[model samples]
Target: MHAIEKQKSPMQSLAESVLDAHTANFWLQKINPLWSVSQPLGKIIEIQSAATDTVSLKIKVNRHFLMGKAGQHHPVIVEIAGRRYERTYSLTQLDQYHVLLTVKRIAQGVVSQWLCNTAKVGDVLHFGQPYGDMTVTPEQQPALILLAAGSGITPMYSLLKALDYSNKISTQTITLMYWVKQHADAAFANYFESLAQQHANFKVHIFHTQEAPCDARLNKNHIDFIKDLSNSTVYACGPSGFVNTAEQLFTSAKNFKSEAFSLTPIISDEGGFINVTLTKSNKTIAIPKGQSILVGLEQQNIQPQHGCRMGICNKCSCNKVQGATKNLVNGVENTEPRNSLRICVNSAQTDLIIDI
Candidate 1:
C-alpha cells in the first residue's frame, strides 16, 4: 500500500505542478504574445568603410518570421577556441527582411577582431534579442544633436536612417558631431557627406584627434564650437572616457544627454576559482572557472534584479562589501574598496563578501 501510494502521489504532484504554473510563473514569459524571438549570430553581408579605421557592418539576420525595432541593439555571441563570448552591437538598418549591424574592429578588441578577420557573408552568428532605450519616436518632434566618437556613430546612423530614409519623423535639422582619430576613422563619411550635400538641415562636424587635413581637433576648441549652437535635444554615445568628457564639456546651462557602453570589471582567482559569500543569507559558496558571480548565485536559485543583463540597464548594480573583479571587455582589475558591484558583470575573485 505504501509503494502504491508513493507512485500515485508522484503522479498527483506532476498534475498539480502544471496547474501551479499559471499562478506562480505567469510573468516569466514574454510580455507580448505575438513576439517570437531568436538569437542567431547573423551573416555578414557587407562591411563598409566610413572614414579611416571606422567600418560599418551589414549583417542579415536568420529570420523567415519575426522582426525588431530599427534602432535596438542585439548581443553578438561567438565561440572561439572552445570558449564562448558575447558582446552587444546596435542595428543600423532594416535592409529587407534581414538585420544590419555596424561595428568598428578595434585592435584591442576580441569579437571585433573576429568580425574583421574571420566573419564572412555566409557565416552564422548567435544573436540575442533586440534591446535598447534609444529608439526615435516620429511624434517626439525634437531637434536632434547627435554626438558620437569613433564607431559610436552607429545609433545615430540608425536614427538618421529612420528619420530621413523612412520619412517617419518631421524634423528641422540634425546636428551631428562625429569625432574620430582622423578623417579616415569616420565610418559613415560618404553617407553623411551625401546627407550634407542634399539636405539643408543635416549638418556634420568632424573632430579629429590626429592632425588631419579636413577637420577640427576634439579639444577645448571642439567643445567651444557648440557654445553658440541652439540647445537642441542632445543624444551622445561613445567610449566611457569620451562620453564622460563630452558630458562634462556640455555641462553648462544647456541640457545634454549621453549613454555609455562601458562594462564593469570582473575578477577571478589566479587559480581559476573564487569564493562567493552571499552576506544576506550568511552563506559562502565556491565558484569555479568560467562562471560569473550572478550565475554562481543563481545556480542556487537566487534570482537577482537585472535589466538588459548586458551591463547597460544597471538594475543589478550592488555595493560590494569586499573583494575584486576584472572587466570583461578590457582586462582591467577593479577592487570593491567599499561598496556595490553590478553582479551581472562582476565575477567572484578570491573570497568576496557581498551584500547581495
Candidate 2:
C-alpha cells in the first residue's frame, strides 16, 4: 500500500518538473501575461448587461482555478492606468467550465465602473481563490428566508438558481425579499418571476424603494414575514445599514446569516492613541483608538496592500507580534501574540508591533 501510494504517474512527474522555477521561467515568459505562478486566471468569454449600470462577465477558467461553493466570492485583479487594483465579487457558476461575475457600478468605484463599461470579451484576468460562508446545502433546511437589498441579490440569486436547476428544491419553502431603489435597478426579475410561477414553494417579493406612489422598505412592520422566523434559516445581505436592520429584527431566529462588504468609517467611543510599529518597514506611527489601522497608516503616507477595504477579502490581514486590538465590527478586543487580524477593520487599542 505504501509503495502504491508513493508512485507518481508519468504526466504528474512531467508537470512537476516543468513547473519548477528553473524550467518555468522559460515557459512563463511566453504565456505569463495571462497566467501566474501563484494564482489562477480566466478569460472573459462573453459580457451581458444585467441592469441599468450592471454587467455580468462570463469567464472560462483555467486548470488552476479552484471551484467555489454556491455563495462564495473571488478577488479579481485588473490593471488600470498602469496600476493594479483588486476587487472582490460574488460568483455564479454557469457550468463546470464557466462562471459569471456580476458587477454594479458605484458612484466612485473605479474597478466596478471599468468592468461594467470598458471591459470586453477575450480579456484575460487573474483571480484569487474564492472564499465565503453564506451558502446552504439542499439538506440543511426545509424552509429559507433570503433578504437582499440593492446589489446584495447576487449571491442569493446564485443559491436559488443552483437549487432550482438541480431539481433539489422540491417542497422546500423559500421566500426572497429583495429591495431596490427603482424598478429599473432590479436584475434577474424576469427569471425569478418565472421560477416563482413554476415552483409552488418558491416566492419572490420585490420592494421598490423609489417608486412613485409607494416606496416600501423592510422594517419590523413586515409582520407576516417575521412570524416565520422561528422555523426557517434566514440569510440577509446588502449595505451595512440593511444587514444591521435585519439582524436586529431577526435576533431570535433559529438560524440567521448575513454578509456585508460596506466600508463604513469606524466610530469609536473610546478616545486615545496607541503607538504602532511596522517591524518590516521599520516605521512607527500613532494610531487613534477608534479608527482602523488602515486609515491611520494612509494618513501617514504609508500604504499597506489591501483589497475590498472591508474585512471580507482578508487581503490586508497581518501578523501581530504584540499589543491589543479591537475589532470595529463587533468591538471584540484581542491581546494574543502571534495572531492574524484584518487591519482594515481593526483598531489599535495598545502599543502594537506588527509584520507589515
Instruction: Name the best candidate (by TM-score).
Output: 2
Per-residue lDDT tens digits for candidate 1, residues 147-178, read 88767788888878777766543345577888
lDDT of each: 0.62, 0.80
What local lDDT does model 2 show for residue 83? Answer: 91
Which residue pairs come into collision in candidate 2? none
Candidate 2 all-Cα RMSD: 4.9
If scored against the real structure, what TM-score would every candidate get? 0.65, 0.82
Error of 2 at 211 (Å): 3.2
What's model 1's TM-score? 0.65
Q: How close to the true structure is residue 102 of candidate 2, measured as C-alpha lDDT? A: 91
Weakest lDDT window of 10 consecutive positions for candidate 2: 1-10
* lDDT (C-alpha) at residue 323 in model 1: 84
